[model samples]
Target: MSTRTIQTSAYGGMNRKLRFNGKMKSREIIEWLREAKQERYYTILKFDEVILNSAIIAEVLDLLRISSRHGRVWERVSLEFCEGPVDLVVSSLVLMDCVRHLFLASDKIQDDLMDRLSTALRISTSLKSLWLLIPMTEVSATHLGSAMKYNRSIDKLSLSGSNWENSDDSDSDSDDDTNDGSKSLRPKLFGKQNAGNSPVENQMSPRDAAMSLALGLKYNDGIQSLDISCCDLPDEAMAPIIDGLVGHPYLEALNISRNRCRIQSVEALGRVVEDDDCLIRSLDLREQSPHDALEISPLSFALRQNRSLEALRISHNELVDSQVLELVDSFRGNASIKELDLEHNNITEKGIPDLTKYIKELPSLTKLLLGGNAIGEEGFNFLESLEDDDDSICTITEEDLRPAKPRSTKTAKTSKSTAAAAVSNNVSFLTGIAE
Candidate 1:
């Protein structure tokens, strides 16, 4: 007798027809998988916070085993586990041949599971995109790097929150040697580590994990887009990773935002952009450590020399007038840049003239984001001057011109006449704007 056909209700794409959320009956899921035909119509499957047990594990294994034997199966699969045997479930999925994309997000994953997943990645030939949002250990990162050395199919890798704090080992510093005497290298990422949780086995160290990832990436040639944002990476740890990506041929987009990186790490990233073979088109360096005054000359130097980068985000880096001037001056001859984000920086009227001049000269720069800065009335006048020329190619949005804070009454009154004059020239250019 022919088995009953499973008609899934969820739809994410043309082939995405299966979706399981929260708890599911083991027998029903098992029956559905067992009865599934060779001509499986569903290619995408997602499981969110599903409770797990032995029957679920056995059923999943049976389905994967059958699908594997039938050759490559499945296109994309995502699993967000809240509890239960994550290692077993994830490992089985990783080993599946011809699974094009795999995303696993969980906080319960342990080192042994990460090791298994890394081993599976080493021999896989079909997976192309991998997103592991699980908490990671240094040993796990080392294994992952080793796996990346042999794997060439994956081009997009996101390890966002991979190094997030584990409940079992939250407050402990993973790298004690970093704090021995060096003032430059931070012992741990701020707001990311606290010392109250129960100790866990084989805890992750950010420095060692970053070093291992760098070593692995140095050999991997297929990765193009990489995201390690919000990983709580410090300068000492982040620098080596930047160093590894210096001469990468295929790597293009990199996001290292919201880290504890200081100037040392920034300089290393500058070297990567300065490389003659660098193909990086977009770079993000936002929300770095605000307490430290980072010198941005290295990035300016690299920008002046490099021609491949198009989009740059250095917002929330506490750039003052001098640094902003330096950055604008570097854009004089370089034409590849199309968008720049200087939002939430410390730029004021002192640097607006140079910025206006540069934006005018570089017609290629179409978007200039300056929001969240205290550009006073005079600085607003500088931007208004550009708006007077109706033929100008660049257009700064009103949002881009908004000030970060309220203007002081003294300064507001002092520049009242200048502001009025600027408004008269261009009534539509950020009218009634104040810092």
Candidate 2:
């Protein structure tokens, strides 16, 4: 009797043949695509620093579309380019058809380039979120309105940049304009407000354009969170933007940290908070310190009126002990606030007593950050005393304040060496907030 044998192909043998063309790396990409096809989700597709040509991006988008069945339910897509023409024309039909979360970051974005991109985004009816990271000066009012025209599904928008301040030399000719046969180049404090006009209308400033973009999106129902951090916006520039948040009912989180915004802008924002129509739950106005001569009473007044805010972050501001006490006092009787961050402020022992009193009174507060302040062992002791007396304060534990054993000199040296090695290897230590 002769023995007969049967052989079966690998588990994904057919799929591999159909997609990968028998190469291992290509097969992996194919496998990922197949998985994405089935799942209908994509996230964090970071391609920054790579000089990809227009054709390559088109191919990538095509592959994404093929995997996603033409982006019917794809969730997140992050495309970052460091060097390229910000405007790269593709199949407009395909680009306009995408309905998903889109995040675009580039270093060389220009007004004209953004206008074209905005035109494409305007047609994406299903876009749920839009994040644009570019130099703030590059963004114009025309581009902003065009991008937001048809984007009704977007619920979150974040725009970040580093250098937004125009150099003084650029405005040097303004002094001569007043004496010459030309009109003064000074910006008007209050200009004609046109409901239908672009923010860039009538020689408006760059800051005005930014404010217009923010205000333009106020009526958009899909917007829930807006973060415009590190944009270098000064007090005068941020005034209109702060005022624009008045009627934004759906806005929950607003972050304007690491900018040049002052107490005056914050006070203006406080005015927005007083409006019942504003639904902002969290406000981050960190890293903006007021000049010594400026009065701090307005900030306290603003905090008192912002009853709906649940989280307040005012870290890295050089707040005096009295101001900190006043701020903490304002939060008393307000129950919505659950977190307060005053880190990096020069708060001392004098401020701790008032802070402790406020914390004890605020029944809803769960997280309090006083890190990087002058509050050392004494402050920790005060917190410990409060914890001991109040059993209801369950969130923060004694372990959080307990100091770890001091590292030995050798161990410290070794750790530093390891960190240096990691830096040399280009390893990133960036991590998101823990949920």
Instruction: Provide the RMSD of all predictions against the true structure, rounded to 1 decimal.
Output: 12.3, 13.1
Model 1 C-alpha lDDT per residue in residues 319-396, reported as the tens digit of each score: 888888888778777878887888878888878888788777765776778877888889888887666544433333
Which portions of model 2 miss their true places by more than 4 Å?
1-46, 54-58, 61-71, 82-99, 138-141, 167-206, 290-296, 376-380, 389-435
Best by lDDT: 1
TM-score, every prediction: 0.78, 0.67
Clashes of each: 3, 1
The superposed Cα distance between candidate 1 and the true structure at residue 321, in angstroms, equals: 1.3
In lDDT terms, how accurate is model 1?
0.66
Q: What does candidate 2's lDDT look like per residue over 251-278, in tens digits?
A: 8888776556766686778677777776
Q: What is the C-alpha lDDT of each candidate?
A: 0.66, 0.53
Report how far off residue 104 is in candidate 1 (Å): 1.3
Candidate with best TM-score: 1
After the best TM-score superposition of candidate 2, give how far the Cα of residue 208 lies from its true spot, in angstroms: 3.7
